[model samples]
Target: MPPRDPSALVAEMSRAEKLSLVRGTADPAERATGYLPGIERLDVPPLRLVDGPLGVRAEGERATAFPATLATAAAFDPALAREQGAAMGREAVAHDQHVLLAPGVNVVRVPHCGRNFEYLSEDPVLSGTVGAALVDGIQSEDVIATVKHYVANNQETSRTQVSAAVDERALREVYLPPFRAAVAAGVGSVMTAYNRVNGTYMSDHADLVGGVLKDEWGFDGYVVSDWYGLATTVGAATAGLDLEMPGVPAPGAEDHEGEWPDGIPDAGHAGLFGDPLAAAIDDGRVPSERLDEMARRVLGQMARIGLLDGRERTGELDSQRHRDLAERVAGRGTVLLENDGVLPLADDADVALLGPHVHEAKLGGGGSSETTPFHSVAPDEGLRARADGTVTTARGVPPVPSRSLFDRLPYLDWGRDDEESDRPEPSLDDAVDAAADADVAVVLVRDATTEAEDRDSLALPGRQDELVRAVAAANDRTVVVLRTGGPVETPWRDDVAAVVEQWYPGQADGDALAAVCYGDRDPGGRLPVTFAPADTYPASDARQFPGVDGTAHYDEGVFVGYRHFDAAGLDPTYPFGHGHSYADFAYGGVTADGTDRVTVPVENTSDRPGREVVQAYVEPPTVEGVDRPDRVFAGASPVELAAGERREVTVSLDDLAVRRYDPDGGWTVDAGTYGIAVGRSARDDRASVAVDR
Candidate 1:
């Protein structure tokens, strides 16, 4: 039988049934986080939504914890991202979930953004490509994939109240592309952010949601507001916000300041979607046809995901196969930032694993992306399994405290704060002694950041910085393994023998780090965002970051991440796309096809196997009146090679990459002489080719 027509179902639904389809149940606990009951007479099933950028974030449920989206973004491989998304989707189905609220494609406008780990990258092209892949993978599993935090939801501070002051051109070129890609990938849902875009709230923004997204982009999916994110009834309904998420905040939920208001649990009946919406329709504040459109969109997504056809939950959730996939994806994104002959430690070499995180597994950040993994591998246990010599360990510092108020909540805790009572906490002196006695010191450092608050600074949070510096002083062959969600300033960067950026490597954190350090796996990951000194970032000023008076102005325009550094001619600690492998790769040359494609030959120059990410950046010719970045990332290709293996990879610079966003003309591909630089990183240009468009 053919799929059900959403219009026919909407026409059959009465006013009460249609309103219920748009808003969740009046009781929050009874309904899934983002859910709306179906009309019983019409056999419409309730939509059950769950959070899952990393994994299925179902409370009290054990699931596979995959690496952070930024970690996978470092791989620069869409295929791997798709597989990871499929794994998450499989587990979502196993958990009986319908819509997976994930694949946050918001551009990492600032490193200090609290939720940067949940996003893909600073460049729109990379974020869009990776986001589309995840959407495709999730939809393939007969599940609805929600690409979230629509528009410039770059920061967490004042997220609910602040306005992101982004201009038209920047929105078109830098911020909107990823969501556009997700729509193009056939995503079933698009989630609005908590903040306002310009002066209007995104949930009720007419130009953004209705004009740009629905009209221009031709998106057929429904627009769901963030949890407790809906601000109005008629305005949002008319502006194209199809569903109000968690229409009622869950019972016992407190406001941002940690205060629970009186009679909040029963407050859902009076809000945007229940009685208020029905009243609006009766008074002609909103047309009855608009309500029909909203119901049609929601039912259409359910029909598309096969929910209307009785798709069952049968996929495996926490098996060893899923764990193996997590390990593989984790290892691929472990970036070897700096190495000076100390990495790939010999199996027989005595090692000292010193840090608070040596035994504890900081799998991921705090909040909705959090997951309860079946099991987690700690660093010492993984090294003990791989190293054939004595491996001593010491805790250099105490674990950082959870600063976010949500971390203390039961639902958001996700079993991450539980302590292993049997392990003894070691001190800084013990770590220094262990470093002096061992052949090499492996210092495990972690920066624990959570949602709802931007990091106070980029420096390592606690006494870990002192511990690292002391350990390096004790042993010249000290290696610093940073397990963080995103970039951090390294004051002792030059002093350490090596630095490995293992960005929240999920459940396989220990084993993956062990594999990279012991030569079993190459550190194939690259930096998805730029690593610069705290003061060098574009939003370093007080007026720009966190914002003043609830407004964040995008003063730098299109120059974000490496683009800022390139335009200012300033050097970052490590440029974007920077990473190290056991083997070296040589770029033969770059040739353009004169159209929208370029091919580059890369060869492994060492005896060891390696992976290379060939990055292509376009240097636009100077236009008299227009301003552009020094160079923009056009596209990239990732290649794996055996010793002495070579391959010529072709990269296509689609219109999104090659063209510039015009305020009046839209996306325009101008006729000009373009310089394409093919290199390992944004700063390392190995070869260049000229082409005319």
Candidate 2:
């Protein structure tokens, strides 16, 4: 049968019917109660939508649970991410849901932001590439994938009202890239954020929703406001916002009476039934033809996603295929920061595991991003399972007392209260004593929670730096595993024998960590953001973030992360893309043809099989008037090579790479020498050719 024409459907509807189409009905029970008063009854049933980005999160029986977005991101495999999305799609179908609200694409701006783990990475390319893969995967199952928190939702505290006071360049370069990528990848819907961008609420920002997203980016999807994110109906509707989420009562209702309040002033309420839409139709504020066009896009997406045809199954949830992919990704995303030959621990070596995070695994970060897992493996259990020799563990820190990094460190808790809890705290003397007897000491220090939204300082949370120093001093072969959701100040970098940064690996994190430690899996992941020393940025100096007036100014502009460090000639503790493997890899055969592409040869010199992410950094020629520094021109494919295997990876540059943003929002490629470097991480690389534009 042919699909219902959206224009015909809209033309046939009354004002109430039009209103009903925009408001979502909660469930079958709610649908039958005439809860959506504006919707006119038709032969066709109302579509059902579910809450999510992680998985189908409706409170019901037999709903398949998947890993959180952070956990999935830690896997760092696009195929694995796609499989996760497909699984969510299948579950959404089972639950009779038309839209799956997910794949939150917010950038991880600060280490302490509450919901940092829910996003992919700090790098726009990494986040966008991964998000696009996931979006494609979900939509492949014929389910609508709604990309969320539209722009600049970097923090959770006061998120509904806080203004992300970023400049136009930073906003375009950092905050908006991922959403643009998702839109380009064919996402069905876009969810407006609760927060404001600059001085305007996301739902009411005509420049963002109307000017940029729709007109500039050529996004054809309907924009829906975050649940209650809309403060004014008139402003939102005029800004090209198509839907109000979670279904709010019509204009001027009193105390759940489901009727307009008596003597309610027009207050723009006269335009409630899209009278503005009708007036806009008459006066050309909005063309009547455009309304049909918008409606058509919505219905077209609905039909494309199988919502109109009824729910369809694409794949089974939590199948062996998905589990295998999950395990592979979990292993791949682990980054081995440092190794001092103590790792690949000899089967006969005695291993003493110390730290609060050892037995009590800190898998995922807190917030709506949390997931109910089928199971989670712990480090001690994984270590014990693999060890042929003895493995002893001592409770070094308590999980509850202080969740910050300082609280878990031995000397940092000297004068704190609440000393009488069941949670054990290892003293400096005790930790030293334990290390004296052990051949190797593994200290699992966790710095997961940071000051959400607003961080007072960039200092390491607790006595973790002290604990790491003390433990490393006591034992020659000490391995420090720093588990955190974002970057931390690692001042004692030179002291520790080995340091591994495990960014909030999800439920199966323990197993993933163990896999990297035991050399069962090589750490292929790299730092997506730069790790600077404590008190680096201007925000750190002010001792306030998101500011008092609910606005955060990005004074750093384009110089974010490594870009800042490189341009300013400052050294970070760990530069972006800094990760080490047990095996050695070499980069050579660097060749670039000035205009389109660069190719590099990657050789695996070690005896073990591994993958190397060949990052290509570009330094565009200086323009007389352009004030911006160098940008990442191109990056090569992630080369997965076996022992003694060599492969050539080619990187292609686009017009955006060489383009410099003008003051008036235009991009121009300056004619100059561009440096092309290839390496495992940003800090460790070999450069060869320079492209002259």
Local accuracy of candidate 2 as per-residue lDDT tens digits, 332-431: 7666777877876777778878775567545455433444455566778878887777788775444433333223222223354552254555566676
Give all candidates' CA lDDT scores: 0.85, 0.66
Q: Model 2 clash tally?
A: 7
Which 10 consecutive positions of candidate 1 have the poorest summed lDDT? 260-269
User: What TM-score, computed on C-alpha atoms, does each candidate reach?
Assistant: 0.96, 0.85
Once fitted onto the true fold, the runs of candidate 1 whose alpha carbons sit more than 4 angstroms away are: 26-31, 253-270, 403-405, 408-425
Off by over 4 Å in 2: 28-48, 51-56, 60-80, 249-296, 400-434, 448-466, 538-544, 593-595, 663-665
Candidate 1, 1-693: lDDT as tens digits? 457888998888788888888876543344244667677798887778888798988755778989888998988889988988888888888877888998999999989987888899999999999999999988888889999999899988777778988889999989999999999999999999878988898999989999999999999999998877887898898899999877765554433334422111122322478788889989999999999999999999989888777755567788888898899888999999999999999999999999876886667887778888989898999999999989999987876665443544533333544464456765889999999999999998887776777787898888989999999999999999988878998999889999999998999988998999998999989898999988899877867787888889899889889999988899999999899889998888788987487898889999989888888888888888888888888778888899999899898775666788889887787789888888989999999999887
Against the true structure, whose lDDT is highest? 1
